[model samples]
Target: MTDTATTSSSGRRILFRVGWIVLLLLSALFAVNHIAGIWFIAASTDEQQLFEAFGVVNLLAIVLLVIPYRRREWWAWLTVWLTILPIALVVVFVPDAIGITYVVTAGVMSLGQLATLPSFRPTRTAN
Candidate 1:
């Protein structure tokens, strides 16, 4: 690649990494918010358990976001989908203000994941 091309490529990679990091942060924040919401709101035991379970899953997704995928970009893609699925379910089941929040956050996070796809190939060292 030409010098300018290399610089541009490097910049793109940095941007992708930053985007992924942002998604991770947002996911963590969402999970924390869900936990807090559960604590503040009065709910049946079953409902509390269900929301806590979802929060745990979100926490796991945040961890998955940081794992080294190397050549397996699909893993990263899968992580993004997994992160969105629960929120999508909540939106479907609730269809209220909280559901709207889940949908919007999931949408933004999905966009970030999609933006990173072009540069998602395996690293040279991983090959």
Candidate 2:
């Protein structure tokens, strides 16, 4: 590749990396918030457990995104869509602050995935 082409490719990769980092940070923030919510917001044992579980899921998302997803592994992408996306979508209909936040985060995450679609595509080699 020409110098210009190389520079552009690297720049694009950096952009994608930054996007993922932002998503991971957001997920971590939400996770911590949810876990702490048990102390301040949960009024019952079940609700406390529910909040903790959400925190766990958010942590899992951070792990997946940082490791496998960053490497463009197909399974990680599928896992996020299959697990996280559905949960966020369901929470979106709750008509509450947390619900709205969850949906917005999910939407941003989805857009990130779509924006990095080319990075995940299989490359072709010359014969």
Candidate 3:
């Protein structure tokens, strides 16, 4: 590749990496919020358990993003999407039940994930 092309490609790679890192940070923050809600707030057992499950899913996303997703593994990306898409659908279908905050947050995270798609594109290999 020419110098300019190489430079642009490098810049894009860095930008995408930053995007995914932002996702990881977001997941961590949500995980903490969910787990803390279970302990610090007074909720019924069902609610507390539901929040705990949310926390666990967030933690799992963090791990997946940090490891295989960073490596641009297709399966890892798909797995993360599998987890996110369902929740996004729920937020879309039942906005009132989930609340506006989550609706907004889900939109932001989905946009962020979309922005980072180039990072997960399959690389070409020369024979």
What tens-digit string does per-residue lDDT give for candidate 1 at 45-109? 87788768878887887767767533335866766787677876788888999888878888887
Give the better candidate number (1 or 3) by TM-score: 3
Counting only residues 3 or more apart in sequence or on different chains, how many pairs clash (N, Cα, C under 3 Å) in candidate 3? 0
Taking all chains together, each candidate's TM-score versus the true structure is: 0.79, 0.80, 0.82
Off by over 4 Å in 3: 86-98, 123-127
What tens-digit string does per-residue lDDT give for candidate 2 at 1-127? 6687677678668767776776677778878888898899899999898888888888898888889988889888777665357447756457688677778777887776666665676654445
lDDT values for all models: 0.74, 0.75, 0.76
* Root-mean-square deviation of candidate 1: 3.7
Q: Any residue pairs clashing in model 2, and if so which?
A: none
Sort order, lDDT high to low: 3, 2, 1
Residue 52 displacement in candidate 2 (angstroms)? 1.5
Model 1 Cα displacement at 123 (Å)? 9.1
In angstroms, how far off is 104's CA in candidate 3? 1.6
